[model samples]
Target: MSTLTKSNHIGRKISRIRELKDMKQEALAQALGLSQQSISNIENSETIDDERLIDIAKVLGVSVEALKNFSEDSVINYFNNFYDESAKGQILNNSCSNLTFNPLDKLIEAYEENKKLYERLVQAEKDKVEFLEKILKDK
Candidate 1:
């Protein structure tokens, strides 16, 4: 049987790293201030610019060199070494409870954004009211 050789694909590396970190496309998109469709397009791309690559590395919590030199073997070895108990025939209970980023942090960020937006909207309304009141007084 013939074996399939993979190309040196940077997109695949980013995708794999993202998956290993248990991050969804939407989360990565949010962190990068990009759309989920943009993330998907990036993953489907074979190459990325250096500056953007740096941003992606920062978001993924890895160095640019690490992304360039990413390999399945290295990742597998890392995991194998991480869970030493797994070598002893113990089943690993990998659960969703083990999230890379804190949910509370995201919630707080959302709350702060919403608060700022609401404040802006309220101020705009107040300005409109004040302008109308001045017009009525003039009339």
Candidate 2:
């Protein structure tokens, strides 16, 4: 008789959302000006006041409704389908996409940057030698 209703554990939802956002309890506590122990207590709570929940939502950068509606299954689904509709149904979430990126072009760009740096270094050495020559001539 106890298995059908959805869980309304607001604190648990908050905890999950915080973890998904890569935030630690200590960081969240600092944002809310509360101690870590207080954050722990809040997470262990089954329900939070509306005002407190709104404050937590602000710190987490989510709407209060988003916090309340957070679900592990939904998150998993969202990440598992990370392609944009404009991609023509191409799976663009990883390196397996059929994009036209040339590694040789990237290598050439790196070489050009390195050549500029080498030129700068050589000019600096020449400048140092010139300064030293001036000093020796003065002596």
- Residue 70 error, candidate 1, Å: 1.0
RMSD of each: 6.1, 14.6
In model 1, the runs with Cα more than 4 Å from the true position are: 1-5, 85-139
Pairs that collide in candidate 1 are none
In order, what lDDT does every prediction score? 0.90, 0.84
Residue pairs whose backbone atoms clash in candidate 2 = none
Write one digit per residue (lDDT tens) for candidate 1, span 1-139: 2225767789999999999989999989978889999999999989999999999999998899999999898988978776887878887777666767787997899899779879999999999999999999999
TM-score list, all predictions: 0.61, 0.57
> Considering summed lDDT, which 10 consecutive residues are worst modelled in model 1?
1-10
Q: What count of clashes does model 1 give? A: 0
Clashes of 2: 0
